[model samples]
Target: MAHRFQYTVISILSAVLQKCGLRCTRKFGKMLGLLLMLQTKRRMITYDNISKAYPGHSDEWKGALVRGAYVNLGITFAEMLYSKALSADDLINQVTFSGLDVVAERARNGLPSILLSGHFGNWEYLAMAAGVCLHKPLTIVVHPQHNAYLDAELNTIRTRFGNIVVPMHKAARTLVRTIQEGGIVAFLADQHASADHDPQIEFFGRPTPTYSAPAALALKFNVPMFLGTAVRHDTGKYSVNVQPVPSADLSDNPESVIELTHRHVAMLESEIRANPHLWSWQHRRWRM
Candidate 1:
């Protein structure tokens, strides 16, 4: 009953967002972002994150970035709500692709790859748009939302355009199989991986815990890897950049895993630094 009610609320929000269309949804979602910014605790988490990353910045600047981060998140959610109503053409038309030659070459040679991105921009579309663009689907690893009903509802959008979804915990076998089959697999490497056993990487100049599985797996399988992100423009249009991560030359070993992890994490950090607003700052990503 609780899960059903939660989903009902999301459905209501989705309806409103869908009706607004892309441009208007950006406007509407910012309004929602303003409201979300009022939540003191989470807002501070966002603010603190910004401050830690940019210690020299003035309070006003950090505040504005924090606000923009929430607004970015709001817009991401608004855009996602519209996914259910989008056909393949609608999805493809709204997003432009860049730096895709690497993926194209891999496809031509029947090779598998590890696609990685952070929580920046419309990361969902990063994996979604690649399929029809290349005529090959991707296996995407996802974190399961606690709300089982909402999880299914959200994943429905993910799979609608010919992608396979695997929850993080049970994804090991599927990931191995996909690589062996010469299929692409995607993972978001920005989320917190806080287990004591988890390896730490330098993120934003701090020793931050990160998900290293993507790097480890890529090294283990000796697969080519790429990092990509979807940048949502003010007009609500998006441009995706899929750049090669230069992993093929690395020998598959423990040291290689760490090096690959650092490389991808640095790429994401640079993206966030370039556009702080596009990345989510709400997570307790860094320890004080």
Candidate 2:
């Protein structure tokens, strides 16, 4: 009974937000961002995380990044409402792609590739763009939120562009099947992982827990791996960059996969360094 009531509330809220998003203007969007910055605890945590990550920065600088992050998030949410309503030409005009040939080359060889990225710069749109550009559905692995109603709504929106979202719990089998069928599987590997599920690795100069499943899968399937990231430009547009993972000759030993994974993470660290504000600073990514 409680679940049903919650679902009803979520459905109503989703409809209301979608309507508002469709009608939102630049001025009103900025105002909404201000309101969210003032009221959201998550935003506050994001500020705190930024401070910890860059202790040399002044309070003013940290404050600005926090506000900017919320504004960026708000814009991303609003744009998602218009995702289905917009055409590929419209979206393409807003986002530019780089290193696309890497994806193309791998796909041409009939080899399944693992595309790894993080939660930065409208990551959702990156998957959608890949689905359109690669001409192959990109399977994204995600964990459902506790609220079933909201989760269902988000899943529907995410998969609208022909990409598939697989639940993280069943990701192994789904990934294996996708690879065997010569499909691309994309996922973020920077989140904090449960002790039993993820092994500890050095991240951002600190010992952090990260998911090794991607590495394990790549090794088991003998598939090539790629790195992709999107960055928010000053004009509020986004650019996605993809690159082939550094070569590793692991024919004789399987443990080389772990080293290759760490190397990829190191590359991601350089990206995060280039634009620290684009990252999800609030995540307790380094926590044990």
Best by TM-score: 1
Question: Could you tell me the lDDT of residue 217 within candidate 2?
Answer: 79
What TM-score does candidate 1 reach?
A: 0.95
Clashing pairs in 1: none
Clashes of each: 0, 0
Per-candidate Cα RMSD to the true structure, in Å, reads 1.5, 2.9
TM for every model, in the order presented, reads: 0.95, 0.86
For model 2, how does the per-residue alpha-carbon lDDT over 55-113 read when each residue is reduced to its tens digit? 89899998988877677666666566456555666656667789877777778777688
Minimum summed lDDT over a 10-residue window in model 2 is located at: 21-30
What C-alpha root-mean-square deviation, in Å, does candidate 2 show against the real structure? 2.9
> Could you tell me which residue pairs clash in candidate 2?
none
TM-score of 2: 0.86
Using lDDT as the measure, the top candidate is 1
Candidate 1 clash figure, as a count: 0
